[model samples]
Target: MSRKHLHVVDSSSFELNIPEAELELMEEMISAYEVRRLGSRNHKQKSVSSDTAVIRSFLTFIQKAPWNATTDDFDAWCYQIGREQKVATNSQRKYQSAVQGFYRYIVDNVKFQAAVLDRYNLRIIQLVTEENKIPHVHERQRTNERPAFTHQDFESFIGAIDVQIVEAYKFNSKEFLALQRDKVMFYSMYVMALRNSECCDLNLSSFRSNPNLPEFGDYGFASVWGKGSKGSGPKQRAVAIDHADLPPLLDWYVNDIRPQYLQKPHCDPNEEAFFLTERGSRMKSGSLNYRFKKILGYAGLSEKGFVPHCLRHTFTTHASSAGMSLEYSKIKLGHEYAATTQTYTHCGDEFVNREAVRYAQSIINRLSDDE
Candidate 1:
């Protein structure tokens, strides 16, 4: 009865079906998805593309209507996405959510139920859960590996990096290049929750103006190219920087401090590397680990297992306590799966309380401003 049913590409042309009526219903369900997604002004193209691909692939692979898909079919398709297609685990989880959400929409869509269930006793059920995805924390994280950094510890770490620059010489003088570079690198990595490589790979041109967040100016979103190891070619996702405090820091580094570090003889003038060593070139992930070691030592934190990756862990823990959701945190971390994000998330009462009050006040201010 919905407008989507009238607009389906094909009314009935499927080989396999619970019945002709069921197949038409499935088409209507898919049309509904297309309509809703297309109608949204802020539609995520990547999400829509992947969700449609999952549904169509499963439909073709199983040669069955979606309403009749069994748990076994869902399992087999997952195996294909994981092993055969070499999709990242997080991506696989995303695809599963997409599939589940679509089915939920189809079944729960009360207005269209008569079109779907007139003949076949149809039901759509979720096939993914926390246990199924790889969120089980490995034993190493629990015992030997460095624990996620607390908010106070993160502040100490930044202070540790900055104190080196302060102690060495006047700020931004020739004596300060290395320390300044490291300081900016450390904070930028923290702000974006970037993996070491993603941080290192970042070029000056990578920062672009996002119109949606005009207040952050040109440095709000970070589009990081990563996750190639999981067999899906280099993945790129944009992360929004919470920039109430980041702009001035990033600006000082980009304008004043960065040029000082790029003064090596015969340095590529066009070289846009965001973080650079004295010799100049992309700063490798290993160099970042060395810097972490040095800074952690200065801060009196054990540097043995506390590596650059731990900065990412620290970012996640701090962000979660600051009221960032697991979904946005995953995007910030460039994680394919939310479980991988949960592996790093920790919250302390202090940070949560501070963030909660700030957020509540912000809401109150907005309401007042409206008046």
Candidate 2:
């Protein structure tokens, strides 16, 4: 049977002539535009999905207004919705843009009038100004603090995890499968420095055992579907792995744990997800967080203010501490700019002091020779 079609309702008049196919096409176009914002690094699908959600919310609200609604109508709607929902300024801006973009699309493609488009733009600006009137107190407070992690603190955390694993595994009844999985996951996140979503969406098939160019010392690599990769952008990137160092962990996951998990009667091998739950279902963002929290507690680490993204931060920090060049780090992190990678270079004072002492010694020797 054919699926029931979706419709995009015109909020102003409660008109619902938009067909599901048209809505889907419009959503695809908006998603394309959103992915374009990422510049590069291939996260198109994520961007599209985000934009689609934002636009869908805006459309649902807009369709409730009169068909001949004026700028005042749009403005009033924005203020009412913004205040009612207590939406943040950034969120309000997104909604406004979504509404404006939807109208622009209708105008350009559906023969919507210039006047209607002008009204939409005017309402967006008005809403933006209204939203900005509230002071961004939280942002002002956060301006002085950097968002990256420090090398020493990160190492301490890892060391803490190691100690916990030794202690916890001694008493656990479930054979430490979960603990092992978390350790591998944590190591993979730090070693590869993947975004949480990228890690979550990774597929077992993407792990190549005998990757190309093995003679050049190339080892296994993961074909990651990065940001802007879903729609029309770069779909995949081959991230090289130091297989000699990391391969055994992947081997344990794929050959040992994965097989046992998949052998269950209800397991869905075709799900295309690398991570699975105890029930053999595909792992989700929430499950990743739950696992991360459980592991953090087991490792005797404080869960407060700790986020999974910190693993990415820890990777970059440790790499910088090890004297890895910023350019190399940037490339490995899939960052488009050197500055983005620079944020992760929170080296400890000891590193700075050691470098300073070396420099001073070199200067002293040179001066003595000159005398």
Q: Candidate 1: what lDDT?
A: 0.71
Model 2: lDDT equals 0.60
Taking all chains together, the TM-score of candidate 1 against the true structure is 0.56
Tens-digit lDDT track for model 2 on 98-201?
A: 55554554444432234334544322122234443334345323422434445445566566556666776788736366656666776777778877777877
lDDT of 1 by residue, 140-172 (tens): 456237467766777788898778788778555
Instruction: Show the lowest summed lDDT stretch of 10 residues, model 1.
Output: 2-11
For residue 207, model 2's alpha carbon misses the true position, in angstroms, by: 2.2
Total backbone clashes of model 2?
18
Per-candidate RMSD, Å: 11.3, 9.1
Best by TM-score: 2
**Local lDDT at 120 for model 1:** 60
